[model samples]
Target: MKNDTPKVFKSIFALFVVAIFMIGLFYAFVSMPKGWGVNVNNRVSRLYILKNVRTATRLLDSGKFFAKGMKPLRAEVPYKPIKFKKTANLEDGAANVVTSIVVDYRGFDTLGEVTVLFLAASGVMMLLFGKRVKPKRKKTEPSLIMYVGTRIAFAVIFLFGIYIFVHGHLTPGGGFPGGAVIASGILGLFLGRNGYTPNHAGLKVFESLSGIAFVIIGLIGLFSVKSFLANFLPTGIIGNLYSAGFISLIYIAIGMKVGSELAAVVDSMIGDTKEEWS
Candidate 1:
């Protein structure tokens, strides 16, 4: 009864706080400048309409399907399709704008998101599964074809993942996809082998080092450029293999961290299953 009383009080207090927050938010919104929410000129829609018209006019006049170096006709448009098209390549050195946006513009947010993912994975492992136990099982060797095929596939998949992350600045794929691919490759090995146990120490070391490297790189950026995860290194030529400066480096770190973390998760799940079976 005493415990229930405290819980009831806590719930009531929480509801009160939420109500106060909502009232404050409503007041703030209503207190804003007049016509702030309404779109009079509708700049965004106008820009889109203008762009389409201009493109169609160019095609009709020149009798060509493609228009090269087509600049925005409107000087006072509120929104531009490519926000930093002119300076993105020069500033971030990434051929892909998505890479520039993720690693250069909103890097701190990405770091927080990655941290959250890692924490969620850890929490799931710890809370859902209390302790890990090794279950004794009959020793059985995998088929010759299965063993050989998995070995070859593992190497290829891992290398491909590395390639994806390394070329993230110039390509469509990035750290997250590459890391997932690598983790999937590792998972393949676990499924193929009977008593394959992932090296927890090695994975931990890789995860720790990559995480530390990411922080160190961010710290370096902070010290040099006065911003966290700022592009401190030289931005090489765009569309080149060795370009994008810190963006590629950060992607590499992210790939390693995510890959190791996911691999650890798979190992934990597998261990839990083994314990349950025993």
Candidate 2:
């Protein structure tokens, strides 16, 4: 009877959990509010110093003669100059800046994404090769590029990955894309050799350094600068390599860390696992 009571309690608890989960799922999908339109009553100020728009009604049939492409009228707040250092002048002569921002200026997002990649690689390794048992090794060598020349070619390819990362602030590609390219080099290495794995320890080292660099930079804002991500860097002459203060340094670190971590993760997935049991 005591055992029966315990079983009954367990069943009740399970049912209660299921019911709560079902209700939560129901509310999450069915009753979530999406603010589609502007709410005048809930105005929030911005640190970018932009001003509220006094009038935003379309100039339809008005005397103002805008150009051909200005027909589409829109309401927006007044523009204001954000209190940040200029990034126009950099040593690397690159035109595109959005990519630089993602890979260098806003590198926190990249770090989170790289961590996700690491977790994914670890999960794959655990799923396929964890708790290993004795199994027959597949003895056949892969007939793909196993030549010495191929490895030499891949060395150049890996260098190209580094080039991409280093020039990330100057070009369109940043950490994520550059990392993928670097991972391709490691993939070539894995395909060309037996049991060759990417450097996981090196990846950890690079990742830690990049994270520390980002934290130190953010800390500088607390003491030297007012805003959290305010670019207090000195803007050197535009169009010069290394001209953008701090941003250039930030991007290079992000590129190296991202490339190393991603390459290591992919290599681990493909090369580290042993032969599966039949």
Candidate 3:
């Protein structure tokens, strides 16, 4: 009876704690500013910010064109649209507005996507967990020309991936595609050799550091500008290499993180897990 009493008390205490936590969570959500769920389709700010339209019916519903006292202009007022190759010294000045939107405006969403991918990879690794066993039969090794060609191809593919992400703000491709390309190169390396496995410790360290750098950059924006993942750096001339400020930096971090993570996934899947059950 005494032992059962303690167990019952513990269960009740845990339930009480959980109830308090739920209440706090509800309050926190309710405290958020009204209009947080504003419809994206109705907002003129996003369209104008991207500079896709030469003329707009209205100004941004929120945000400073240059000052805060200015409220969003109604349709009656003429809103000056940004010109390509002409608009310099604008905030989030990537020539490719899509990149600006992805890495700047919707950065938190990007982080969530990365997190989801991480979770998926972790799940895969956990499901495939087992002791690696060498095959009883000797596998045929790759030919010399095939091995040499794969190494050369991997180097080219790897560099192309780096180039894609590095120039993400100026081009069509970004971190996700760039990382996938790099992973494809790593896959090539695996095919080149019968017994090739990437360094697990190195991949883990690289992935952790990349994720940390991403969060740190976001924190810097949050502290400096009072907005998470806000553009805090000076945006240079449009269409220039260094124009996009931290958007490029964020993409680089994302590229590294996604690349390392996918590489780790590949390693986990391909490692010898087949063991003869006695």
Candidate 4:
């Protein structure tokens, strides 16, 4: 005998909202200009690929566009082509062009990405904030073989994560992936045992220091070269391990920050532990 009017109204309202959203999305898709972001000949894209962003900027500011019919094309910038394992002392000397873009050309965007991740992790911790205590029912401890195997595996996984971030400038993997790999290892640790609690205090300290290090590195670049996150240090040969200047250092900071933050998030989600960040 109960009325279903309220339920019907809610369903209708939800459908109406969804329809409106879909309509908007469809309109946006149809309105987008053809070949919106796929233009490889765009000036920004060209500069990014050329690794001569600084020179390009100066040239453009002096009214010298690279294309025809733009201020007489001032003096042509004789940019040497990049060669792997042969190029040396180039600007942003990262062998991996993507690394150069992410950490050097678009570093501000990368910082924002890290900040967003930090905020998400902080939200999880805040929502799950409470004193840790054992649950009424205890989880069964892991088997001996599982525990031993996971322990050994965790070491290798952790080391591999470090290597990924450290050699980010020379490889496809970077701080984000490296941190994710390390977090996966931490997750394995959780599965490797029952009632395993990570060092909450140490994690907090480590996360804070990593973020601070990233900011300090950017500030040093700002003061030294009047550009935030500039490659102020010496960029060695492109293929060398010590190349890419501060890009390597920044990736290290980002890896540590993301790894610790994600580990903390995982710890918070696996609540009912006896650890406090004190």
Task: List the lowest-lDDT window of 10 residues for candidate 4.
Answer: 69-78
Candidate 4 has an lDDT of 0.86
State in Å the error of residue 115, model 1: 0.6
Residue 207 in candidate 4 has what lDDT? 92
lDDT per residue (tens digit) for residues 1-278 in model 4: 38556878899999999999999999998866567556555445566676777787787777656566654232355467998888887877888888899999889999999999999999998878878887565557679999999899999999999999999999889999999999999999999888788898999998999999999999999999998988799998888999989999999999999999999999999876553664
Top lDDT prediction, candidate number: 4
Q: Show pairs that collide, candidate 2.
A: 89-238, 90-240, 90-241, 91-240, 91-241, 91-242, 91-243, 92-241
What is the per-residue lDDT of model 1 for residues 1-108, given as tens digits with 9 covering 90 to 100? 754667788999999999999999999989665665765343434423222334444554774433434454333333324332343435457877667777877789
At residue 236, give the lDDT of candidate 4: 86
Per-residue lDDT for 34-149 in model 2, tens only? 57654433333221112222222233335342534564333232343422234443322233456544533445676576567667766765566643333347687766546575
For candidate 3, the TM-score is 0.73
In order of appearance, the predictions have TM-scores of 0.66, 0.57, 0.73, 0.83
Query: What is candidate 2's TM-score against the reference?
Result: 0.57
Residue-level error in angstroms, candidate 1, position 261? 0.5
- The sequence of per-residue lDDT tens digits that candidate 3 reaches over residues 1-278 is 75466878899999999999999999998966468575444466556455433233223333324254545432323435677677787756887767887888789999999999999989988877777876556567789988999999999999999999999998899999999999999999999977787888898898999999999999999999898998889888888888878988999999999999899899888887863343
Clashes of 4: 0
For model 3, give the 10-residue run with minimal summed lDDT. 57-66
Using lDDT as the yardstick, the better of models 2 and 4 is 4
Q: Estimate candidate 1's alpha-carbon lDDT, on a 0 to 1 scale.
A: 0.77
Error of 1 at 83 (Å): 16
Off by over 4 Å in 1: 1-89, 128-132, 136-141, 273-278
Q: Give the Cα-based TM-score of candidate 4 against the true structure.
A: 0.83
